[model samples]
Target: MKAGYLGPKATFTDIAVQNAFPDAERIGYTTIPDCFKAVINNEVDMAVVPFENALEGSVHLTTDYLFHETNPPIRAEIIVPIQQHLMVHPMQYNKWNEVERILSHPHALAQCHKFLHNQFRGVTLEQLTSTAAAAKYVSEHPESNIAAIANELAAEKYNLKIVKENIHDYDFNHTRFIVLAHSHTEILPSLTSTYEKTTIMVTLPSDRAGALHQVLSAFAWRRINLSKIESRPLKTGLGHYFFMIDINQSIEDQLVKNAIEEIESLGCHVKILGSYFSYHTQK
Candidate 1:
């Protein structure tokens, strides 16, 4: 099987893909939408895309594309612990004191906030498209006094040396990546039985009294546990938003199906995003 991930290589998303499908043929796309497009166009058998981060919250591109662009079923989920390391070109000054500028993706840079403030106080922080992109830049500019905050895999991939390890501010940092395909059963029949989550997009009844309350009541009366519920604006007009809800149980459950049907009966629109299991990997 072939798998595509967001990359120039060595980004957190790339690492997750590597962990999940180590033996599959791996391909890298430049952006989140590209990965989704690849799955829709069949450029690859499957695509791994970052869905959410423990520290930074949901990846907007991933959420938006999954909700509006293409509604591919999520086959599985991979949870990867994130560790950002400070790396520099081998030929550049080895000492951390020699670094004048820090480079990484914006989210990665933000994740190392305390480290940047306390250690590299006056240094400049440059944002790139991806942490791997920053590593590539530092590797190419050997004479420059720049360091990249990326994963150890990035250091190995770019032939750079890690000067500081685990520079991220938090120890519990993790990013959730989802595997998407045209059909889960077609991609991997065994995974279908592992389904544990049912995500749905809900648009509530407009100008109706207790509309939001009624929506929650639909699930509450059925005793269906909600793992997550977040709102995103519809963008068509003011005060128009949709809720992305995750039911703890699989969509195949009769109660879960009935609860969703009841939600729709209340003049609300519902769309099932996917029903899949979460896969956790140890570092």
Candidate 2:
């Protein structure tokens, strides 16, 4: 599998992707959008992008792409626990007295919000696109008194030190990621099963009360068990939005696909977010 993940390597997403497909060919993109595009354009076999983060919350970009991309299908899903750490340059530890700012992805900053406010107190915070990028930035700008919050691997890869370990607010915090593929291959079946999942996003027809009820009813009436359903503003028009849902089944299951088709035909758009993996259990 040509797996694409958010990277400079050592980011939480990269670690999760690596854990899920250990031997799969890895392709790192700077942003989740690029990973989505890679899977859509056939540049990669599967692209891993985070759907939601336990502490930091949903990865809006990844979820938004699945709702709007309209091209490549999400073929699989994985929920990997994220262990966030505070990493800084090895040489900067002694200069902690000189450090005045911290850097990390927005979500990363959010996750460590309380800790930062309590510990660092008045240090200025800067945002980077991803934790990996933040690690790289501090590494390259060694003279700057900026440390980054990232994963252990990122610290190692970028030659940083862990000022604090397991800094996340919740130890069980996890991030779920969806795998994207343009087309399923012969070897894919071996990777898919009922234990896997199928994700779909749909928009309700109108603000009418039963719009969402009917759409979900299609699955419930068929006895299809759903794992998740979250709604987001459509962002294109006023007072309109779409929903992202996941079911514990395979896309090949006729009932699941038909239900999806039924929703689309009802004057609402439907998107297949992918059907892959059960929970990416951390061992």
Candidate 3:
């Protein structure tokens, strides 16, 4: 089997793929949308992309694409611990403080905001498509005085030297990545999960006074446990939005099925994104 992920390699998504699908062939794409397209186009058996981060909240690009673009069933979820480090080309190991710029993915830069503000106050912070991309750039241009904020694997893969470790502001840093594939595709046996989850997208009826409250009530009365509930703009117009909810029960459960029916009866539309197992990986 072949797996696609957001990468040039060694990005967090890549690491999740490596841990979960160790024996499968790995293909790297430059962006999250590219990974999704690869799966939709049958370029890969499945695609793994980051969904949300503990410190950074949800990845808007991933969520937006899943809602507006093609609908691929989430096959599995992987949770991985995150550790952001400051690294530079070996040539500038000792002169890291005098670096002209710091580069990383926007989320990574934000995660280490306090560290950067306190240490490199005036340094230029540039955003790249992925953290690994920044490390690759610094590696290729050893003569330049630029540092990258990325993971330890990126530092080793790009042959960069670590100037500082664990630069992220929060210690409880973890990212959730989801695998997208058709229902017929069978995931490799190497992947194991700790629990199960079911995610659904809901669109409430407009102009209804208690439409949102009624939607929640459907699940609430059924005694269904909701893990998360977040709103995203439908992008049609002002005040038009949809909710993405994660339920702790599987779609196969009778209570969950009944709750969906109750919700739909109230003139709301619901889309089941997936019902799959979730895996947790240690650092």
Candidate 4:
């Protein structure tokens, strides 16, 4: 089997893929869309991409792409702990404090905002495409006074020295990555299944009063537990939007099936993104 992920190498998405599908042949792409495209184009059997972060909320790019572009079914989910570190090229290890700029993906930079403000006040912070990309840049430019905020795997992969470990502000930092494929894909036996989840996209009928409330009521009255409900713009207009709802039940469940039927009867559009098991890497 082949797996595609967002990376040059050693990004958080890559780490999740590594932990969940170690035996599969891994291919790295530069962007989340690239990973999705790879799966759509049959470049790989499946693609793993970051979905949400504990601290950073949802990855909008990933969600938007899934809603608008790729539309692949999520086969499984992998939750991996995140530990962002401040790393510098080995050549600048001694002068790490004197580094002029810190580079990382925008999300990583935001995760370490408190640390950056407290430690490196006024230092230039630049957003790269990915954390691993920043690490790669620092590694390639040995003479530059730059540091990168990335994971330990990235530091190891790029041969950089981690000047400060666990630089992210919070300890409960974990990211949810989803496995996308055209059909069913076997999950690793080593992972521990946390729960079953069924994610669906809902578009409420326009100009209908209480349409949103009615949609929620369909699941609420069914006694279905919703894990998450978030709204994303449909991009057609300012008021046009759709809701992404995650239920803590599988689509195979009779109650969940009834709830979807109830919702659709109200003139709302529904799309089942996936019904799959969510797993966490064994500690």
- Listed per candidate, the RMSD to the true structure in angstroms reads 2.2, 2.6, 1.1, 1.3
C-alpha positional error of residue 99 in candidate 1 after TM-score superposition, expressed in Å: 2.3
lDDT of 2 by residue, 99-191 (tens): 788888888888888888878888999999888898899899877778888888888899988888887776787877776776654224223
lDDT of the candidates, in the order given: 0.84, 0.77, 0.92, 0.90
TM per model? Answer: 0.93, 0.88, 0.97, 0.97
Best by TM-score: 3
Sort every candidate by lDDT, greatest first.
Answer: 3, 4, 1, 2
Better of 2 and 4 by lDDT: 4
**Candidate 1 residue spans exceeding 4 A from truth:** 184-195, 207-209
Residue clash pairs of candidate 4? none
* Candidate 3 overall lDDT versus native: 0.92
lDDT of 4: 0.90
Q: Would you list the clashing residue pairs of candidate 2?
A: 74-273, 74-274, 75-274, 75-275, 76-276, 77-276, 234-241
Better of 2 and 4 by TM-score: 4
Q: Model 2 reaches what TM-score against the true structure?
A: 0.88
- Candidate 1 has what TM-score? 0.93
Per-residue C-alpha lDDT of model 3 across residues 157-241, encoded as one tens digit per residue: 9999999999999998999999999999997536567778999999997857888889889889888999999999999988889
Give per-residue CA lDDT, model 1, range 1-283, as digits (tens). 8888899888887877766667778899999888888888888988888888889888887777766865578878888898999998888755656698999988899999999999999899999989999999999999898899999889999999888889999999988888898774355422223337888888888857788788888789889899888888787788878888889898999999888888889889888888888777775
TM-score of 4: 0.97
Query: CA shift at 153, candidate 3, in angstroms?
Result: 0.9
| Candidate 2: segments with Cα more than 4 A from true spot | 186-194, 254-258, 261-267, 279-283
